[model samples]
Target: MVVFKKFNLDKQSIEVPGTRVQGATGHYRHASYVNGLVEHIAEAPHIKTLYDLFQNSVTKYGDREFLGHRPYNTVAQTYSGYTWQTYAQINQRVNAFGSGLMHLNEVILQNPQLNRWSLGIWALGRPEWYISEMSCNFFNLVSVALYDTLGPDAVEYIVGHAEIPVIVCSGNHVSTLLQNASQMPGLRAIISMDSLQDTVPVPGATSPAKILRAWGEEKGIKVFDFDEIENFGAEFPRKHLPPLEDEVASLCYTSGTTGQPKGAMLTHKNFVATVATNREGLSIYLPLAHIYGRVVDTNATFSGCKIGYFRGDVALLMEDIQELRPTFFPTVPRLLNRIYAKIVASTIEAPGLVGALSRHAVATKLANLEAGKGVHHPLWDRLLFNKIKMALGGRVEVLLTGSAPIAKEVLNFMRIAFCCVVTEGYGATEGMATATVTLSDEYIPGHVGCPRAGCEIKLVDVPEMNYLVTDKPYPRGEIHIRGATVFKGYFKDEKNTRDTVDSEGWLASGDIGFVDNRGCFTIIDRKKNIFKLAQGEYIAPEKIENILMARCNLIQQIYVDGNSLESTLVTVVVPEPETFLPFANAITGSQVGLGDNVGLAKLCRNPQVNAAFLKELDKAGQAGGLRGFEFVKRMHLTTDAFTVENGMMTPTFKVRRPQVSAHFREQVQAMYADIHASTPAAKL
Candidate 1:
């Protein structure tokens, strides 16, 4: 039996419903509930695999559009349209693709020694990627995913590690694989999604198909176009090798921020269980190569919901949303942050009365929400909020954000602006994308709600960094999770697998968080990311970074660093130039205009401007109630923000700390060098 603890903020008290269970590890296990029901693992005995989920959905919603794609014009070399496939059509393609893989497997099995084969998809978000993935599960072949942005070396590593014999990829990916083909001995075939006849010729080469064919002939490998496989499969009998619930459905690779990417083996049961506990109806925008996006896609398919694909260009996502009019939008914090920044900028730039009215309407709505009253301002809703809602296609009833923590202000603003329920989820690749999620009606700021139906969560003390379960206000420690949603293990790495998951099945999340008396969890910082200074004061850079970002509008991006040799913290800030321009001008009492790169760079190093920013930083730190050592004592401002193309941010929009540190090594050293200097440090 599970017990629930309820916390009343107004009363400043906690009420536990049932007796607590003390584990042998000296940790307390307190189960929680939402809407009076204790969370327990969702049971789905009928659904055994991804194939079963798809079949069930096809039976229920065969005529509905299940997948969408944007078509490209061959002559003009531009995308001018969108198309969709019904559930029935999707089933047909999946069956044909599966049958084709089965036929290929038979051909490969003629050797009589090899018992298993793997299929790899190395493409962007497209219909064929979905078909190929499902086909692998359908034919009982292992499915391996390769990131489109991966370099030649990472590609070779993943291909060799998975022992993938066949790969389905786009033209660009074919070029990459061709470059590293000699290194990947097990890879035998390449399936191009685009037909050779329709593909445009690369600058210095013939058509990609011709190049691939010549290369394959040279390397003793076979290459096939997408249509050929479908046609061949149409002639062959369908193969029906059902996958077991415990069988590995897909091998998802980590983002490889610290080192070589490790594949997390996600079982069919893991996916099915995730879908069973998920809500339906979402427009897919995230990359399918990632587990977070893939789980959402699979869940939408399993729940008989229409999934609209974004145009390859992410800049056009808002336009796609306007066209698709999806009822649910699954997103990350970066996109939401951009949306918030754009809205604020546009509203501020609006001329005269328009700007005043927009600001007033937003302020009124936010006040109403904060006061625990209904947002029923009809006049404001019609004039302001309704237009805001229309920007998201006017049909979205729920918004889900995860992958990173979002600002409380942004989350609240979006809810009121869209007139919908916005929920945050907490999960990772190791946990199949979800271990806990916020309930529909539970609107607690900064809290990621309780554990999901199928998950159990607990906290363990980390004494080295001074995090303990008995901390004041709320218990703070490292979070550990155990559930059906947790992945099996890392593929082909027993040592890493053993290190990640313990004998009792609990996987350490590496995230330091605290559970509120109400069971709502709030993540503080990553355990591994915490560093101790020369004075033995532990610092959680992410915690300080989030606070500074939330409190300071001028800070677009920030990275905090400390070392055992240093007693004070140092920071690198990417300032919002538009916001910083006014501050700089105000500090100097002169109009320092934007777009003059040299002038802006000088302004970033200006003594007066730095002093003002340091004051702002100090205020923000004070507001966040940080210790004196946690506040940044030395800082440098850079105009360029961390970005994926620059290798400073991951594809998922997380700051690659190692990369950022390396890129800013000189600046870091300069900051430390000036620690004892007589000169005042530049601080922004």
Candidate 2:
């Protein structure tokens, strides 16, 4: 059993029934219950690898539905049907697929010239994607996940760098790969998940097999349908599955914020450890290409929880939620913020007594929650909170949000509104999706709870930025993590890997945060993102950006940029349409109609409107307790929301700073030039 460090909740720690307490010495690094679970997992002899976990789950729940997906026509926007596979059924497919892959490997090994072979998958949340991934695991072939949103260039770079021999992809991805096939010399075969005729067909097209045959002949690469491989495997009985130890399992590429993306090498042991520390029951909506989604899927599968996939369209997520009524929902801050904004808007704008009662209920519930009282009042629970719960499918027991820091108000509102435990975790691609997760009972606003089980965390002082562990009340510094869940290293990048993971086996997170009395961590800023201004004050743009977007209703999205040469900050703002339109109309004394892109663009550049927006920024800054240098001094408002297609946001929804900066290069230059020309900055 692992002996965990202890922390004192108070000088005299008292244990309540059904609640575990950290030690009285105030030294425990992990939650008590989490430590118990980790120790239990460590002691279990059968749970050694991810495959082992899956086998165990199959043994326990063979007849239960393991995976589910909604089938719909993309163009028609009509639901065709729904499909589910039981654990036993899925096991049969995985075994057959694994055997087929082994057969393919045998063929490759017979060649004298070939030394390495791997497979890639680029598709959405479909059964084929899951089967392919599992088959790779069973056959000991390295699985490379290709994001569906990746452009042709990025896809080529990743495919060539990884030297992928076979690719199983959807129709759109097939077209992308075909465009750059000449650039990828290592690619051998292409398997279409959908019918080739439906995916890529000529007018008066022939059969899918013939079309694929013709295309394959032209490209000099073999092409097959998804069913062909399965059928090939079905000719033989399932092969004996073996447990894998520390072998490299998957190569998940990082979202390239600096330059080209690097593949992170995640081993089977790393995944087993991560899943061992996880709780069950999560509705997986995040793309599987992301580490966050992968961890959730693995954990849910291992824990024998029924996993549900959303319809391809994200706009229809609520519909899926209502249909599935999942017990837990894993989400990111972006979606939660939008939900909060919409609910607040609807409540305030509701007509007559209905709106008044809604407002009163929210206010009462919030007040009670702050005072450490029950969240549900009998009257309010029926009239307001119950309806709110129904909207979230009515069965949500816990809501987990991560990938970014949510506003404290939004966090608190979610807890009260849903009357469920809302947890916020901190993780990165390097850490296998989680380092710290908030406990159910410990719902501090901005703090991601204690270090996870089997993970040891320590802070190193960065005096240059004035962060120190010896600070009063709370100790602050750069967080370094050491754990089994950390990735092995960056694939084939020894120098970068050495720089990331130190000689002491500690991975420098590059994130600066502080620990409070309860051993909870509150992230302040990122070390790389911190910039010093000409006036000698350091500014963390992400910290300020979160504050602004969380507090200001008119601001939908923002990118705060500053340089060492400039004393003040500048921002590119994507305004909230509903909020900005009304505000703009009041200023112009004329109704600005909705969907008027040209008029909105002109309004964004108007001097009077800009001045008012500056005041709004000042108000938001004051509300967030921001420093003087943290306030936005100049701004450019755009009607366009940053999206993945525009190269402004990552697939995981993180703002791409360099890309956004480059796209708005002219506006940024003009903002700086105005300041240099002695044009007074917007009055804050």
- Note the Cα lDDT for every prediction shown: 0.73, 0.72
> CA lDDT of 369 in candidate 1?
78
Candidate 2 lDDT tens digits, 202-272? 67757666765676668767676677677668875455555476778889986453457788888887888
Best by lDDT: 1
lDDT of 1 by residue, 1-684 (tens): 111223333322122334233321222222423223222224335777888888887887889777876687868997654577888998898888778766665664343323346788987777888899888777777888897444456778898998888899986677667777899988778888877663565566577567678888788677887887887788895767788889998899874534577999999988877775553212233212112269888877765566667766676777777777767788877567657666765664478988888888888888887776654478888887787788777877778887667778878888888888787888878888787766555445787766665566777788876788778787778788777788999998999899889998888888888877666788876778765554334567888899899999989899998764466899999888889999898888777687877777878888788778978999999898666778898889887789999999989999988789899999998988887464332111
User: How accurate locally is residue 407 in candidate 1, as Cα lDDT from 0 to 100?
Assistant: 70
**In model 2, which runs have C-alpha deviations exceeding 4 angstroms?**
1-28, 31-43, 73-77, 108-116, 197-204, 207-209, 236-243, 279-292, 349-351, 530-684
RMSD in order of candidates: 12.3, 12.5
Candidate 2: what lDDT?
0.72
**What's the TM-score of every candidate structure?**
0.73, 0.73
